[model samples]
Target: MDIQAVDRVGMILALFGPHRESVTSTEAADLIGLNRTTTYRYLNSLVNANVLTLREDRTYVPGPTLVQVGTYAVGRRDVLKVAAEPMQALARETEITAVLSLWGAASPVVAHVEEPPRLEVVVSVRVGMQLSPVAAQTGIFHGFMAGAPSVVRAAREMDDADRERLQSSAHATVRQGYAAQVSSRGIAVLAVPVWDTHGLAASLALLTTRDVLDVETDGPELAALSRTAETISRMLGSTRPAMTG
Candidate 1:
């Protein structure tokens, strides 16, 4: 079954992780204990397979295929199962809509949602909807969670003032552990991160009319949402300490 080849490929892929996002051919050669020529050849094969992209600077980064596979893997995590009951309870407690989102390749994508019963009006957030990173509070929160490089790259199309505001919002999200935005229609969305052992695994958001929901940092809604998110995060093996209410 070409076991040796498989092992070598696995080694190459293993070179990528949180601390090491890219690798040069020389680095790959040293990591795989192979010659530079052989390492370059292997990297080229991976590039052809769409698992890695050879950047202009000769570094190899995760390519489209890896991102697709990663997104699929994230979609199947137990976070969804762990969050289901808590989200339903949250919806009941807040009398609003509860949404679960995951980090997509380039943005935040809605994964699941729970709406309060008998609520004639609710935000129409559907699963698999890709949110606007520059516009949505949830997306800005995820952009912060994704790290600064991703934010800067995504903001390349933005004007200076918008970029400044976006950066400010992202930092605020990190410091406060949540993001909030109110729409012109008086709809308010408050989003908080649901962390896993590996960091932010998903975002949990509550949506309702501005009058029905308070977006204050220490408000009742944020407290309830934080509690529910804590429950889910603990279930997902997050090591973060419980927030003091």
Candidate 2:
């Protein structure tokens, strides 16, 4: 492999972060420290190769081929493989939906979902859905992923107050091993971190009605979730100590 070619490709990909969904050739050149002519050539070559898409506005975004590659990579991850059975059992035990999410370009994306039977009004979640980075529920990722600081910085432009809230939420998630939020629709979501030897691999979450998660009554449910996450982490060779509330 030609080292220069590899470096150029890597730089091109790195230019597309959570904040930048699309970029013009000039912007890409400036960001990557390449000349405008070289940037245009590289961008066009990527577009031809289906690694990126050129928009009508002359900007570029990740294309179908990148998405296809990402989906395949997510599917083959060991964490998802180990999480399958435990996630299903979690949904069954709590009668709530179980979600497995991974950090993506701008936020957490659902990598897998399992819904419980006999739930009259369960929340609907699908694989590949992107959760809001600013939402309190996603603090689980912010607290654990090694790339979390960069992700947070790129996901959205925020004021000081918003930054403070995000920091506070992340700190709380670190202390409790999980994060919880009530949706506007009255659905409550609790999420726990799943670790790998490399750091945060993903998040395992339970989604249920607000009424089902009474603080006084859901102790066992919370414990079960934590244990399940620890089991998954162990399967992935994580040696981190178990999280405690």
Candidate 1: regions farther than 4 A off? 1-75, 139-152, 242-245
Candidate 2 regions with alpha-carbon error over 4 angstroms: 1-43, 53-64, 146-149, 215-218
Residue-wise lDDT of candidate 2 within 29-77, one digit each (tens)?
Answer: 9887999998899889999999999999999999889879877987789
**What are the clashing pairs of model 2?**
none
lDDT for position 6 in model 2: 76
**Top-TM-score structure, candidate number:** 2
lDDT, model 2: 0.79
For residues 22-80, write the lDDT of model 1, one tens digit per residue: 99999999876999998898899999999999999989999999889977886588898
Each model's TM-score, in the order given? Answer: 0.65, 0.75
- For model 2 the TM-score comes to 0.75
Q: How far is 53's C-alpha from truth in model 1 (Å)?
A: 23
Clashes of 1: 0
